[model samples]
Target: MSLLRRLVELLYGSDRALRRMLQYWAATCVLYVVCIGLVLVQVSRGMTDGETAHRLIVFGSWGALAFYALIRASARLGLKPDQLAVSQAVFSMICTMCAYAISGPLRAAVLVMTVLIIAFCMFAARPRQTLLLSIGSLAGAGGVMYWLQAHDPLRYPPMTELLTFGYLAGALLATALLSGEMSKLRSRLKRQRRELSDALETIRVLATVDELTSLVNRRRMHEVLEAEERRQPDENGTCIALLDIDFFKQVNDQFGHAAGDAVLRSFSIAARASLRANDVLARWGGEEFLLLLPDAAPEDARHVLERMAERVHGMPVPGVQGRRISFSAGLATRRAGEPFADAIHRADNALYQAKEAGRDRIVLA
Candidate 1:
């Protein structure tokens, strides 16, 4: 059992890691294609040997297909992005070393490109994995260069001794600058995405939340109720409560709308505190509120509302000194197969009864 649990955790962890890694890998693949295309455009224009050109094209196509398949398979296995990025970086380093070994004159360019690629991968991948890949790529490059120099010294003469090392230095410098610019671009893009997400969330909150009571607005309440109904198909057994502040209009006329708003806000806070986390509370309109209690019977809903009313009545508003805010609540349980509107209507009628019988009490219908 312990071994099985460990295996499950390992699999889940790897999946999460791969998902994070895959995002970076996707970006890296785009950059890789761009670089390869540039090289191909430059080299292919002068090539007359159909056989050599065909071989080059075939290798490039195969490389792209292989990378795509590997990435797709990883995604299918539910790998997380981070793990995918690290794995791809390692694979890229391996391929870079292989390419350097197979090609002679292209070794300098490949070496510089591999270094830059590895550096970018390191910026995105875990520290340990990045270190391992960097070391492996460097060792592989050195080994291949050594072997080539030993076999054919003339073909692999030291570039440092020729042309004052200007070309080699220039290539390395350009690679470094390009890698740094790419890193900055990635950072800027990530920041922009985060800011946009935050702005959208803010707009959503403003649309769905009431500014005065801090409760959900009417539209949001309907959306939530519908979602809950779908989740709990037997919601016919659920209870709905519609509450209106008793003498709210009288208070508004006597003390002004500002005081009325304060009373409303205070009552909402108290009522919310009196309910459970799963219970829903919303501002149903001016001086009115609604509560939806899933899996609650009529008796239970009444008890909950009675408690909420008592709490609100006991709450003291700053401007309404020595005066308590009271509300009449109507409680109704849905009958089997009853529509949402009918249940609300029943609750509203019960609320009217509460106001008529005596204010600040729960009436069940």
Candidate 2:
């Protein structure tokens, strides 16, 4: 089992081809073992000549040693799948030729091994390689048949040899064509899977992120608030705040909408810089935003918001002159796993109170 695993790693290197290569190697080993055993049984029964008796033992031993050497070399020097596939094809052809030579013309059943080699090539090699291997296999087999017919006409008659060679060549070429079509389909499926994964990731980002301010959008903000409420224990604190830009419409009225956009971007940058790493700022609507401070009491939330307000007031927008950006805020601390909607409602009322009293102030609920 360990030897089989090593062979898979060396040949396919974790590709989808690994499983097919394992099956091929297992089948090849079984073929050799069964054939060698059968031939030895035939020798014991006195069914074959002394010359034919040597063929199976010699060929089986040679194949075992050659494969052991191939495995060792593959480990010492990393051989890619294509390189290993070509090497296997070459080795199989050499063994087939040796089998034909030993069996003689009349008992050349060893030629069927070429069919197995061609079948293995369908999965292991690319389309071009399969075609080339098929052609090479056909040529080798035809050469063997021609040699037998010319040298031993009584054993291998010309008409019978022609029909057998034609069928063998046709089967090999047909297998190559079918394998090429399957390879193309596999490649297309892999490409489609990758493209679909990328598209889904893109959609998720667009849904959560604001296009203009690069902040979390309102819909995602509600989800975050609800999650935070669930996470807070009875003893822990969760602070949330809603803020509105002070007289933002006046800014847009005096300076065009483009300048208003610049102001919003600048405010987002300044507020983000003033807050802690764990704090989350999200766009609630046009000229309105929400901020979340996890594990923070009402006082801690107020201090953070005050610092943010000062920072935002000092920050200057590029297109607006003689004006400083300021925002009115309302903050509420949830009590013992309080619902998010209840806390946000209190914050909204506090925000209205601040707006009525004066702009650019924080009122706690």
Candidate 3:
């Protein structure tokens, strides 16, 4: 387990993209080890120059290790590793070209290394990026083949290099096309995730908001009350007001339900505009609104509702030609050691009194 933690620390990545790049670098380092082992075998068989192969192996191994450390160091300094993987691919290809320039009869081994580097980049880079890399690899290898054939065509045969070039071109082109399709799939999944998140937000709004008045619905108000009930007692006190529109049914009967709806919408806008930042007003039921004011004394709560009443009184009914609307409110402050429902019950009693003693007045409990 400790060794595993050490390996993860060596990667030094906290995000997916950078971690993937680090992992890819680690894989290429392993490939480097295998290639170095192959070079040692070619030395034993006397197939390649001993001094040139040894120098390539030593420097290539050091370069691979240094690349890993550089990526880790830069990530700690907040540099993103998105483009660094491409640089590694290009660097490894250049190293492979250097090896190919001196591999004699073992040049095919260096060509295979080029293939693996570009194939690894196919997974990391976009289609256009991978395509450009494929072309670069082809050019590098072609240049090496041309130089070898021009100077020493005895061991590096023209026919063999031509066949090798054709084979590599086919493999790199196929990898590029497949990478393009994979890039498209990744983009589609991201878009689908964004669309799903937006749909969830819309559903939440529909559940909590009233359609006609654009105020919080009864279910959501119940949630707010429950939350307040769980809170510690405040200094001034928490207050709730129950408001009912006066003669609402008479208005609906005299001028259709649509006009009544417009009156409710306009009244809701006016009432909401009069509230303080911390106050929450919800449509408790038809023609009824409940306002919750946290840390408010009864006097302060009454004053705010009275102001709301004046605003509602002056607001013109939207569909009705020349009519205006007014509301009556019952304000109650929560007492210590009392349940919130009991306080609201007292407010309901006060609201009944306000209705009986001619509507459009504020009653306190």
Candidate 4:
């Protein structure tokens, strides 16, 4: 099955037009083959219809081969596939009209085939196109009836013509209405799916990102930490750092909470510029953030933190009077085969040391 699917994909080239053309080609071939087989069976059963069978074989074979060639040529020329399918339907309706003109009993069969063709078009073609196909088929039936009545009045009686054509008109109308409703339903479903996808994306952002600073939240940071730890055994080093804004509570008290928020936002921007591309930064809690540095030793992690502290010191806080914002950070490199929690504990201890020794400093453990 896989091989067959690959072969089909190769033939169809993965474009919608090519795939749709392939579908039409396959269905046409199957229908023709079945008709030819039935005709053969009738001949074998002693029915003296060799001429009819011969005509069926010749016309069906020729039409199938010609249509297949057209499909291939159109694909090479970049023609629309749906147009090709529509052309096939028109050609089939023409053949049905010819059959109805010649054989009296085949007139009813032709009407039935026309109804099927309209139904197929209703699903496959646009609403306007489906209506056009139905109108054309009905017109063709009327023309064939007129020709039969003029040439061979005995073959098609008035009652037979009226019944067959009237029934076909009703069938075409019903099929057109169904196709229009189905098209409307399909459009509604497509719009709803797009809306659902957008809603899901919004929810994901809200869950994983901090709204104030637009940084990853603590929960996402923990996932990154765990993943980094698993990768560290095969890597050179992994380090974790804790950063706390110095005198953040004082900023909130002196100015206002709104000014404190502005400070946090400004600090987040400066810190991002100080870190490398592989570093991960997330809001840990109020006025506190965590940084994960993959492939960094304790010294390398401390350098990054120092640079970040300098950046924070340079940034102006609107709420604060004259003092620039600063943060103290604690850094710890993970040991071989050690649990991630131990590194975080060491980093926390280092943070306490930085706070004790005086704020706005970095301590490495």
Candidate 5:
């Protein structure tokens, strides 16, 4: 079992693309092995000629070594399957042509292997490469047939070789056409996958982010609060705040909704900049936001909010002249056993109190 596993691992390496390339080469190698066996069968029948020696020694012996070398190079170099595909097509054709040149009576049957090579390259090579290989195969086979017929008219008759090359030519050109179609399909599928990925990313943003202010939406905020509640509250303290823009409706009524939107957008950006790295500020609804502070002491959280208030008080909105952005907030520390929703409710109550007392101030819950 261990020996079998090691051999399998040697042939098909650990990398996915490497494994696929090796598997393809293994299949091609098997074709050579099968051809070698047929050559042996011919030799057993008393055919001891240079043709037999060439097949067994050049193709059978040296071909095996080259095959192993190519496999090792592909693994070590981390070559992709597509790159190795072209190399394999070129290498296999050379050995096939060399063997075909001397096969004598086996020349007719050897054309089968030639056709197979063309078919394999049709799928593996790019469209232009497939066209080139197709033309090369037809030309190479025609040249070899003409040479053999002229040299050994008794063994390779002119009429028989012509008919055989004609058949192989038809097959090669037909496959080239089909290969062009397959390449088009491959390109289209890749484009669709990229478009689908982009669409999915857009959908994710819509689900979790507020398109208006680009903050976490109310739905995603609830998810964050629930996740935070499941974990233990920060040791220093976990605080949450509810904030509303002071007299926001008056701004909208005076300046129209466009200026109101610019104010909301500017406030969200400034508030986010003033918050801590671990803090989260989410859009709760229109004119209201939620802020969650983790790993912050009450005093530290208060100071953070106070700094935000000072920064926002005199900040100008883009189109709203003579008015600045200001928000009222209520802060509360989560008790050890309290649920997040309950803490947020206490914070909400304090926010109402802050509004009644005066807007643009922070009240503790």
Candidate 6:
């Protein structure tokens, strides 16, 4: 039993407290059947009467029903191993009391079942629940045993004299060991799960973000835009703004491509800072960006872009060589019946108008 306990601890770690409790219940059931079978064989030898056999079968059937009902109830509740342990412990106490009533050598079975229950409660349930259930199970079992002895002295003397004291001591010792192991395993599993979740979130962020500008990349931007487009014609509104750096190539030619890259990155940071949390900013390509604005009208988008342009102009970019960095923006609002492509085309044309009208401004078509 000590070796088995050690092996269980090694295999399950701390998070497996609930699992171990369920295993204990299952093992108890199997052991009960074997013990009952041995009793039946010995008690029925050379007795041609079917009366004893029939009674034993009836008792076994009732026990089976009780076990099945508890298991089914636990499963329905989505009971974790820890919960199962508490439930099974309660059920085991009831079974032990019933055994006392039957005047059977079910004493061994009840003793084993009681010990397993205590182990589960101590190991699987939370500290408060463990203390509560353990005390409750112990008191309940003791009360039932006392009641049985009072009601029918002959039927329960063995339980009071032999089974009760031995089982209680065994239960307390087993519970102490199981509880310690279970707590350790639970702590370890929690740390492992937290680390795993953090790693997954980091991976997701890296996949969707632009490394240089720290904005959503082109692919992620498209995905977000498409999702917004699908949600249109609903109560919430949607708009897209296409922005291009005005005379960006001139800056690249005069200063260097590195300086031009710095300007693009700085402009992206400014644009992102100017937008609301719901707004999605992404690098569309060289010197171009797309913003998907949910719950925004063409007027609202125009206001947002105007604010973004103002912020960009205010920012200092070393690559701009003493000149202010500026952009042309096209704003398009989704019509109730219009396709996403049509809205995009309208925004593109509006952007052209902004460029055509001496640049550095927002144009709404």
Using TM-score, give the best candidate's number: 5
| Clash totals for all candidate models | 17, 0, 0, 0, 0, 5
lDDT of 1 by residue, 75-126 (tens): 5777544465566666666655555544445555666666666566646655
Clashing pairs for model 4 are: none
- Per-residue lDDT of candidate 3, residues 1-365 (tens digit): 59988768656557666677778887888888888888788888987789998889888988888887777676566655546767788889888888777766777767877767767876667778888988988888888887787777887788888898898888877777777888899789989999999999999999999999999999999999888877844433899889999999988999999989988899999999999998999999999889999989888888899889888878877678767688888888888867778888988998999999899898897
Residue range 79-164, candidate 2, lDDT tens digits? 65566676777777766765665454424567677777777776667889888888888888888889988998787788778887
Misplaced by over 4 Å in model 1 are 1-13, 18-160, 232-236
Candidate 6's displacement at residue 188, Å, is: 3.5
lDDT of 3: 0.83
Candidate 5, overall lDDT?
A: 0.81
Error of 3 at 191 (Å): 1.3
Which scores higher on lDDT, 1 or 5? 5
Give a tens-digit lDDT track for model 6, residues 64-134: 56654554455466766666656656656665555544435454445565555566466457755665665
* Candidate 6 structure, TM-score to reference: 0.53
Ten-residue region with minimum lDDT total, candidate 5: 46-55
lDDT (CA) per prediction:
0.71, 0.79, 0.83, 0.79, 0.81, 0.71
Best candidate according to lDDT: 3
TM-score of candidate 4 relative to the true fold: 0.85
As a whole number from 0 to 100, the lDDT of residue 272 in candidate 1 is 92
Candidate 4: stretches off by over 4 Å = 1-21, 38-76, 234-236, 316-321
Cα error of candidate 3 at position 312, Å: 1.6
User: Runs in model 6 with CA error above 4 Å?
Assistant: 1-109, 126-179, 233-239, 247-265, 276-279, 293-300, 317-321, 333-336, 349-358
Per-residue lDDT, model 5, residue 344, is: 91
- Order the candidate numbers by TM-score, best to worst: 5, 4, 3, 2, 1, 6
Pairs in steric clash, model 6: 14-185, 14-186, 15-185, 18-81, 18-82
Provide TM-scores for the models. Answer: 0.64, 0.73, 0.83, 0.85, 0.87, 0.53
